[model samples]
Target: MSAGEELRARLAVALTRARDRSAALTECVDETELVAQHSPLMSPLVWDLAHIGNQEELWLVRDVGGREPVRRDIDELYDAFRHPRAARPALPLLDPDEARGYVAQVRDKVWEVLDRAPLRGRRLERDGFAFAMIAQHEQQHDETMLATHQLRSGPAVLTAPPPPSPSWPPAVGAEVVVPAGEFTMGTSTDPWALDNERPAHRVALPAFAIDAAPVTNGQFLEFLDDGGYRRPELWSARGWEHRQSATLAAPQFWERDGAGNWWRRVFGVLAPLPPASPVVHVSYFEAQAYARWAGRRLPTEAEWEKAARWDPRTGESRRFPWGEGEPDSGHANLGQRHLEPAAVGAYPAGRSPLGVGQLIGDVWEWTSSDFQPYPGFSAFPYREYSEVFFGGDYKVLRGGSFGTDPVACRGTFRNWDLPIRRQIFAGFRCARDVVGA
Candidate 1:
């Protein structure tokens, strides 16, 4: 196929895959569940359903193709900035059937734009960036909707085969030493990378050791047994205040049974905590407190990126932990193929050059850095996407979780949220400075 033909084919696949995943997420739940706000932190599933279609229409049909608006009157209704999640159910949202039809109509228009456009000249059209952006946007909402599913009160509706078993026995608390060096931090050439992850720059650091894998439930249980949450010294002043005010005892969705064993609810199914799996649904404060209790610290964002992407053998960075190749079923627990995190060391093939395992998926590893811009960062197309959110208020998270799709998750992809927020599938690992390095 010609270059243009190849690009079109890839964009078509990405867009179709996103839509398929969106359908699975919404269809599994009934209309009442879709319309209900599962949590204050998440929009109603129906809102996400229509919002994805609206964003596709706005960015592709109007901005890129310069076509007439599909439904101009509803723009403000679906505007995420205008309506918060808690307020969205009160708005005049398209019901499930209507949302399905609207998205289908918008997608039909998108296909026509794809068929006729030259995919060149304009920056958004170059390399089909706008199309890819829409696909990623839809996939992001798919993840958010999945989170809502976890929050809703219902009996097990979502299910997936458990993640693959580890090929070799995992060294539970093993650490990998990342030697001191300068390595490229972000991407300048990745065609689909968002603005915040642009303009690759050098970040120098001294030697440090990061966990071979994310901290697991068993390890976290040790902290709980030792009164990690009650010991104010283990938490930051702000974290302690939030912990007390919120009565944060364990990860969200977790409770102790009368037998004293911990069980957690996953997508409405209550099960015993899988000790070997990386702990999920944790806030930065919880992760940080655990790190402090362990006498370690969360790795800086640069440190986490360096460990995930840096290739000491070549003194260069890779597009992913495993290399330049895109993720697959064998690589990591991504794309909702599995509903929860895999046992640590499950994907040996996904390990980085430094032998750090499961860095790409399983759980979003919390880092100790604030969301910030790269040295030469400049917003493209718009500022609301990344520029508006940059600051110390948000903590940077590296790696994607089991709920993330491959199109939206990568080594350099950045996800940030308020440090105390915990509804998302997040987890963490610890790092300690190499003494006398």
Candidate 2:
């Protein structure tokens, strides 16, 4: 296919996927459920629905199409920075029916703009970046809406086939050694890469060992059994305070039966904890404490990147752990293919060159590094997408979770959350410096 044809095809697929996922999530619940704020941490599902439409109108219809705003007055209603999520329900926001119609109208105009716009003329339009950005934005909200579903207390309204059963036994070696070297740490040429992932730079690091797979539920149970939560020394001062304040005893949604066996609430269904799946819904503090309890440390962002993307033989970075190919069912457990994480070591085909498994999906793996910019970072389109979040307060998360759409995820893609957030689909793999390597 011609370049424009290829871009249009990809854009069409991404847009369709984003819309479908959003619809599926919203349609599963009644209007009351859509309007209810499931958690203070999240906007009402209906708000996300309308907000997705507003953003598309802003970026694609107005910015790219040069059209007059359809509902310019409503922009502030959806301005995420202008209104916190908790207060969004009180705003005069579009209801479910109105949101669907509004988004449909905006999407119709966006399609017309996409068909005729010179895809190479302007910075935002160049290489179809604006279209990609909107697609990514909508997919991100879909993930957020999914999180709201997880937090909502109701019967399950979502369903998906379970991830493939493991094809290989659990990894025997707990950790893989990454030799000391300089590795390229970000992307310089990826057309749709966000600003933070720009200006790929060389990062030199000492030899280290990282877990072959994420720490599993059974393993984390051992930490809990050993008083990992009660022992304050295992946590950072801030982490300990947060833990004590929240009275966190285990990962979110976990409960013990009268028999003392562990069960977890998954999409409103209480089931025995899948011992082999990577532990999810844990905060950064919990991950750090677990690393300490295991006599290891969380990998720095650089170390985690090297393990997942760097190819020692080529001395170059691969777009993904497995290769430059787009993610598919064979590559990773992503795109809500499974409502929960697959068992660790299930995706051997997705392993990195150095043998790291499930680096692209399953759960967003917490890294030790703070979320910061690259050497020559410059915000594009807007600063809020990433630039504003650059600081020590937000811990960096690499890899995507099952809730993450493939169009919105990449090896260099960065996700960040506060250390105390436990509602996100996050987990961690431990790393330790190789002494005297």
Candidate 3:
């Protein structure tokens, strides 16, 4: 059909997907699925739904109908964006059905504006983009809510870790080394690169070897068996302090029974640790501790990217090691696979130029560098994109994890979490400098 029809069709499809996602999220009732964060606007499913719904109206309604903005009271009712530490925006507190109706109303208006007569308004572009962004944002929260539902709703004490996939992109324990070379680091082009990863520049490298595969639960267990966590020397001073205060004997989700066998959770299922599965749900601190115990170190963001880059010599700065392709189970353990982290090195076809496997999924590999912006970096459409953290003491992690969206996993895509957060699906791979005489 016509260009307008195509745009309408696109918007219509997005709303339909959003509706389906929203319906699934409806199951997250009364904190069964979604544990409301201390701040309501952050994790309360109610706050998320209301917030996204209001966003649609704010962005699309004026264009579709001659509608004035949402009422000020309504804005206050679900305004979670303004204050970071504020309590969850007090919603109208409608029952689920009523809330769904309100959301549907906004979605319907959006479809109408997108589908009907061609028009050019700055607000159209502005709200259209916002609508899309919020819709995607809500979908992400939808997944988390599902896990939260299972986490809090059931008396489900996790007894074991999830089962691992049998094979990965490469054989277990494969290794690769690259000769010294200079390469550009970070994103040089403007195509959805995060600000912290932008204003890309060049970096020099020396010859070094990297693990072809991520560290496995089985391997990490060796460190644990050797009292890795107990040894103060195996940990950074901060890490040692954290370990002492936390008193964790194993990975965050891992536990051993009288049998001394490992078990943990996958998505929602519990099973034993797959010997070959990349260790997951560990935090940056734990990863660092493990790397020290294993006589290795985590890769720098620059070093990690250099080896993980698609074209070793001259590949485009990609969102993933596998290039621009969106993630799927076959390519990576992202999206709603219900499958947990796969066996390490399973997707050889998706391996990095240096034969580093599972660089985009299985787990978010820890990086050695602290999170910081690049040269000439500028915030994009949203100021919160990067300016908030000029010198924020956050560490950078790369290679999206099992729960990540494919779109969220790019070479230039960076994620940050306090080192102490071990609940997220994070793990680490090691890098070492070859000894120089």
Candidate 4:
């Protein structure tokens, strides 16, 4: 295929996957569910649907196609930062049917733009960056909507076949040692990488030992059984206070049945806790507390990246744990193929060269580092994407979750959230300094 044809093909695949995922999220629910604010933490599903279309129209149709705005009046209504999610349902927002029709119209225009536009010339059009950005953006909202589905109380509205059963031996709680050295962090050449992952730079690190896989539910349960939450010394002052205020006994959605067996609610269905599966819906404070209870610490962003992407044999950084290849079903559990995380250590083929497993999917792994910019960071397209969130307030998360789409995930992909937030699909692996290394 020619250069432009190849770019077009990639963009087409990304956009198709994004649109399909978004449709799946909305189509499964009734109109009432779409408009209902499941939680104050998320926008109404209808709002997300329309906002996706609006963004595509603004970027692909108006900017790329050089066409007039289709609905200029509602632009501010969809501006995510302008209004909090709790207030979204109060606005004169488009209903489900109207939102779907609006998106369909915008998509038709976008396809027209894609057909005739030169995929080369302007910065946004060159190499199809803008198209990829929009696809990623839509998929991100799909993830957010999935979170809403999890938060909403009612019957199950979505269903998907489970991921392939584990074929590899379970991780035996072994820790892999990474020697002290400098490895490249972030991405410089990845065209679709956001501004936060830009300007790849070298980072020096001390020798450390990291868990081979994410901490599992069984492991975390042991902590809880041992009064990990009750001990003030095991938690930071802020974490202890937050735990006390929230009265958090276990991970969100988890409860002990009348028989004293652990169960968790999954998309409105209550099921027994899978002992081998990696724990999800954990906040940074919970992760930190678990690490402390285990006499380890959460890996620094540099440490986690090095363990996942640094190849010791070549002394080079890879795009993913399994190397430069695109992820497949054999590699990792992503793209909502499974609503829940696969059993830990199931994806041996996706393991890093150093034998670390499940570094890219199953759940987003929390890191010790704060969300900050690279040394030579520069915002592209807009500042709201990354600049506004660059601070110590938000903790960094690496890897992606089962709800995440492949187009939006990479080894260098950065995710951040408030330390106290537990609604996200987040987990962590413990790390510690190597003694006498």
Count of backbone clashes for each model?
A: 0, 0, 19, 0
In terms of lDDT, the best-performing candidate is: 2
- For model 3, what is the error of residue 33's alpha carbon versus the real structure, in angstroms, after optimal superposition? 5.2
Off by over 4 Å in 4: none
Write down the TM-score of every candidate.
Answer: 0.99, 0.99, 0.82, 0.98
Q: On TM-score, who's better, 1 or 3?
A: 1
lDDT of 1 by residue, 188-295 (tens): 899999889998999999999999999999999999999987899999999999999999999999989998999999998889999999999999999999999999
10 residues in a row with least lDDT, candidate 1: 164-173
Tens digits of per-residue lDDT for model 3 on 318-414?
A: 5567766755556666644544677875566677666678788767888888888777777754566467765776888887776655534567777
Overall lDDT per candidate, in order of appearance: 0.92, 0.93, 0.66, 0.92
Error of 2 at 423 (Å): 0.5
Which pairs clash in the backbone of model 1? none
List residue ranges in candidate 3 displaced over 4 A. Answer: 1-19, 28-42, 54-67, 71-95, 113-132, 146-150, 153-172, 188-190, 313-316, 435-437
lDDT (Cα, 0-100) at 212 in candidate 4: 90
Error of model 4, residue 319, in angstroms:
0.7
Inter-residue clash pairs, candidate 4: none
State residue 6's C-alpha deviation in candidate 2, in Å.
Answer: 1.5
What does the lDDT come to for candidate 2?
A: 0.93
> For all the candidates, what are their Cα RMSDs to the real structure?
0.9, 0.9, 4.3, 1.0
Q: Give the local distance difference test score of model 1.
A: 0.92
